[model samples]
Target chain A: MFWNKEIETLSRKKLEELQIDRLKKTVKKVYDKVPFYKNKFMETGIKPQDIQSLKDVTKLPFTTNDDLRANFPDGLVAVPKGQIIRLHTSSGTTGKPKALFFSKKDVDVAADQMARCLIMSGMTSEDILQNMMTYGLFTGALVMHYGAEKVGCLVIPAGPGNSERQISLMQDFGTTTLHITPSYALYLADIMESMGIDPIKDLKLKRAFVGSEPYTEETRKKIEALYDIDVYNSYGLSEMNGPGVGFECGEKHGMHLWEDNYLVEIIDPQTLLPVKEEGQVGELVLTSLNREAMPLLRYRTRDITSIIPGKCPCGRTHRRINRITGRSDDMFIIRGVNVFPQQIERILMSTQRVGKNYQIVLDALDDITVRVEISKDMFDGNMEHLVDLQKEITGKLKAEILVTPKVELLEPGSLPSFEGKAKRVIDKRKL
Target chain B: MDAIKQISIFARNNPGQIERITHILAEQKINILAITIASSGEFGVIKFLVDQCEKAYECLKSEGMTVSLNDVLAIKLTDKPGGLYKVAKILRERKVNIDNAYMFVQESRKQGYLMIEVKDINKSMELLKGEKLQYLKKKDCYPRTKKPVKSSQSGK
Candidate 1:
């Protein structure tokens, strides 16, 4: 089967033309087979023929997380259960997990997209890729495994945790590429340093593909410095067919969306209209170009990002997207003020003598007050300096987030440490 | 001094919640003499030293709060800045990790009593005893005075 090669490398005008054609076809397909889409179309009184181009995409109703949750298990699946070969799901922290189905053809297309991601990150068939993501219900490990195999690379299905074994495999098997979250990689680097094993010198690792959670630039630098490995950020969701939907090339400018397999749009989050300006951040809305069992149309990702046009240094025709800054859901309002945990993290990391170990505590004291507990580094002497550090952090926080956060410098190693995503924000104001 | 139980209650950090807890104890006539709130964000564990430890635990538990009866070393140290550091250094040398801790000072004695909850209770007690740290039982320091006898005797 041939992919949309022209659309992948097409000019903006021609790419839009191709997208309009595919979107029309996708809408028609969903209208014919998928009851959910057909009903939505009928209710909106918009015919599939009317959606002849990308501009007319807004004519169709927007798909949401609630829609997926409402449909539940097989309610949203376009193909029959017998036709579906694989299933993936979100964590379902909010409620019941949103399940997605994939036909054999759909799985192949996803694998191809993943292969493209690996290639973008400079992976070769000669390279042995060590997948350190969580397996089973989580799609990171398995999808990367399939995609690496598709790229003709030697795949080692080493799921997350078990750092000793991961290091051993890296040393013994001569693993050259690593697929894991950025935080876990840092944890591995910390362990390697404590063991006096220089990951840069001891292991033959060259490229590190990091994702599964949003990361900061400082954290990225720390990881790169620890292993001396070139880090490329990968972006995808279980809803969008796992960690191969888009990836960063060698230029490291932005993640190149596999436009052939997905049509992407950046829309004003509040207005739900197309963002007209360049460099303006908006919500990412994706339409699956070649999904079979469950193709999504205008599905709001809720991830804030900007689109970058022009040719990439890697010569791939696919469009690039700026790194996702933060999630719309992660933004919490306190005292009629908006706050993102990432902004607090950024401020804390920028401060002197403060490690990345910090947590935001929102307490209800008549009005909401934000308390930030920062883990102190033992090496940074002068306890009095911490008072000044706290002042500086409070000042910066008040300036950036527009609130004077109560900053507490805890004793070294006093705060809880996590092997997984660090719990940075604790909202106690709800009580 | 009899061996008195100390209970740690984890509650969401909020205003008036602590007052509600104190009110429950007051209603049950369980006099809480010493308490320290070590809070981070909206949640923190409130460590209490009450006259009737069992009654206090029952009161808090009946209120549907997750309360744990823990063995903590209530040691009296000189009310100075380095007093905490000395205790921390001793624990470090003994290889005992302090999971959580809190402190309160008696105005009359001019000394700070720290309630340290360590991972290894036996090791911590042994170390404190071996080092001759002035450790006191919870009831020995309950109420800081013997004024609650009339209420206990009246049984009202």
Candidate 2:
């Protein structure tokens, strides 16, 4: 069975031996059935007999996002559409969403992985899990629901939004665990505070698993302080069978990758070559060890991270990856320097004068200017003081971001509010 | 001495407001020497220094734009390449720097007039004369026959 306890917590040598054994079997399975893998292996001149160990697996051609896009809908499915029990797709905000299929066994393995993640978060079988992720084509809600059920937890299938209803359910049902995005958790905290119920005191939430987007450490700290719950970062992609691919333990240093199910690789995004040293940030490439319906090999995730190869403080035998810094595609270049929106957010949260409601407007000028509108709460007293505050903010932004930003002290609530993901950066500089 | 006048008008932050203001002056053939706009999200204050101030004011207010007239400078420069640069250099030498300045080309006359806000008006005027630069005062730019409308409507 894939969920063997010996395999789950095997020694380093034993784990490698098992991984090679399973990998060899999985390789042969894909090579025989999957046309895509057969063609890929043939093109690379790598025969199934030559792949004796895991190291030889790298000889195969790497799969990319373009490959998924080209083979959209049902191009990559190994089994017929009728045999596939469930279908889910990754959020293709930039382009078309990549479709993922799961057989009954595939679904069970995914659920077990998620259950292992929840168990690491200190969730008990008696705990109630409130899943705030969206249901439907999205796998977050369903995968988490099944995983929590596997752990014998009372599952609340209440999806995203309707904070009042969620609070009511939490109060009524004594919900002890929450599965939500960081932004939604912040929104919940804000709502609870306005309703005169202290979130830390009122909610019986023991742990929160926040994922789905790249959030800064400052944001996690703020959420933790507000709700007084241990916020664990869960990392996964729909293309890789949703939210239980890997999870952070109590140490919170990095998320331990479920190496048994997926072989995680860190490669330089541009070169597509393996990153030699540890702590060097690179794009994540994933290969499913047991995915039968549609197994992806060397699939570039575009998420930039470094691996912590040593044994985790949590005593898990699986390797850990540092919290994702940002994605290569999401990077914005200004004045020849690459900038990520999360970097600006981190700097903004660190500053005392600037609030969360900020818009970085890049105009078509020789000197790139950033107009940051400070929230009204950051401002007190008169105009002169506000100007001083603006100068202070501008100086700090320059020091950290290495660019001078034009700071504007706007009246409280001058910026547009977001109901979902906050649109932080506005790049007006068109190529 | 030719007169120069500064006018401040209240305008909504919608499309065609600028076009309406420009249309009124273009109808009367009044030349706009320089213009500046200070705007928030919803509204803007349009400040203009025009050659024919009184005629421009009557035309603008007649178009229902709330306008007010004030005194400013209209310094003339040669149509040559470095004319504006020489004027700025002279002012910098005299320590009579400009706080704000705007300009436009006169297509028919082949000359450029600069409407500038200086640190000190008297010092700027003295430096202009000292440097042999020609300029127009507020009164000289406007004709006395045209009168502004006296209404209870405050532009603010």
Candidate 3:
């Protein structure tokens, strides 16, 4: 019953063969068309023909986020401007956002992988799927929308937010499946209970695909119990053509990453060397084999996760990836918006009243709160003025991160200071 | 006009903050004639009308406490319940804004004294003079007997 039974259940040897073939073509194309990659390869004394087998991939240099940022608008483009059809970006960065371009075929191939993942998440052509992922420059909504259409399901591109209207649409359309983030699922469940309508009774939702942010097992259990349905974790980044990169099947173990289209490697961030052993946490470095417009090689993901050792019960030959524990860097996502504590520090440091020490507390995915200490001299016993300062910091933080955070002003020495690594972010959401 | 010196100290409403300030003043042998506390949330203002206003202001300021002194109107009234009501009604009638004020029981016991900080002290003083109300000077507020405590104050 798999969407693409042959490819989904391909043998490991066959999958590796397919990956190597595509990887060679992608390398040749990038070296010829993109000077950024060409210079990197020339400096490293390697040619496209040097990568004869999958094992030789270790010789290639890694593509880090800094390289992407340095090559701003179209510096990393492999394909001509005439063929590029779409562009998507990550939420927020200090400078320009992470950009990914897709050609016509790249778009179809991404949707095709998404269709396979949809089938794995228990969606059939008979199912009426309601997608609640956000749309626009963030690729979550549009990718899933195209995939659901490709699966021949009755699709409602609901986008995100407006929980009340989402409930109504689910009832009106007899929706059987959903594509939403795990945090939003919890929010919707609470809304359904408040409306006095049981999700299992009033809505026809049988299963859900949750991703775009990391969530805990306890949250997964709560979502499954609240909706009386299966909750599958999906994983992808905009650099990899969004949500189609990997998915959880009926087995509900680690997500089965599709290796036929891309090359995936786990490397120790400090050493930058491959961790071949399974079940060891490391940063995910990926190379796009099938992407035409922007064929990224050894693109460092900065996501810390392990590769599950054994083969899955589901026939997919692709290796499984454990749920992301944290980022290799300080970047964390709140309600789908990527945030860095450095960005917060920069904003607070620029403001006059804010002190040197600040802490970010993410209690839940949606409950993002920042506690900052104000300078003692600024607290001149004026209540109205203090409230004004609080409001000012709140507005500035919201504008910087695109998500409004509850800002609190503490006294001179309330927040803790660390001598070592500075544990400024306390993320209780990932527990 | 001899200005009625009022010292304002800004502090957190923590447990030992006000106690510490008052203890320092007590050790300094400074007479605290009138005091008022207005606080909202974690922080507030502590106003004081003491015998040595400049000394107390410099003392707290040197100790890194946020403190400031403002010249205010010190009105002398009869020691009765209606004394404050008469002063408030007069200021209200004359369109003089009283920012804040506090009254103290004078040593004579027959009369009451109030230190009021208003928007314009000159205008309020003119209005008080027209109403035949007596405004005390700096010398009348603090006594000559209190001048000998500074040597011991600075000795510690």
Q: Whole-model Cα lDDT per candidate?
A: 0.75, 0.75, 0.82
Docking class of 2: incorrect
- Winning model by lDDT: 3
Of candidate 3 chain B, the 10-residue stretch with the lowest lDDT total is: B147-156
Clashing pairs in 3: none
Root-mean-square deviation (CA) per prediction: 14.7, 12.1, 18.9
Model 3 CA deviation exceeding 4 Å by range: A330-431, B1-156
Which ranges of candidate 2 are over 4 A from the true structure?
A: A1-5, A80-82, A330-431, B1-156
How many steric clashes does model 3 contain?
0
Better of 2 and 3 by lDDT: 3
lDDT string, candidate 3, A89-179, tens digits:
8855577788889999999999999999998887888999898987799999999999999999999989899888899999999999988
User: What TM-score does prediction 3 earn?
Assistant: 0.58
RMSD of 1: 14.7
lDDT per residue (tens digit) for residues A1-431 in model 1 = 11234445567677666677778888888899888989999898989999766778888888899999998888778877899998888876699998988899987878888887777677788999999888888778888888889989988889889899999999999999998888799888889988889988899998888888788777777888888888888789888888878888788899888886788888766667887776555689998877888888899998877788678866677888988877767666666666666567667767766666777777775233334443322222222344566678878888877777777655334468776667766777676
In the predicted model 2, the residue pairs found to clash are B3-B140, B3-B141, B4-B137
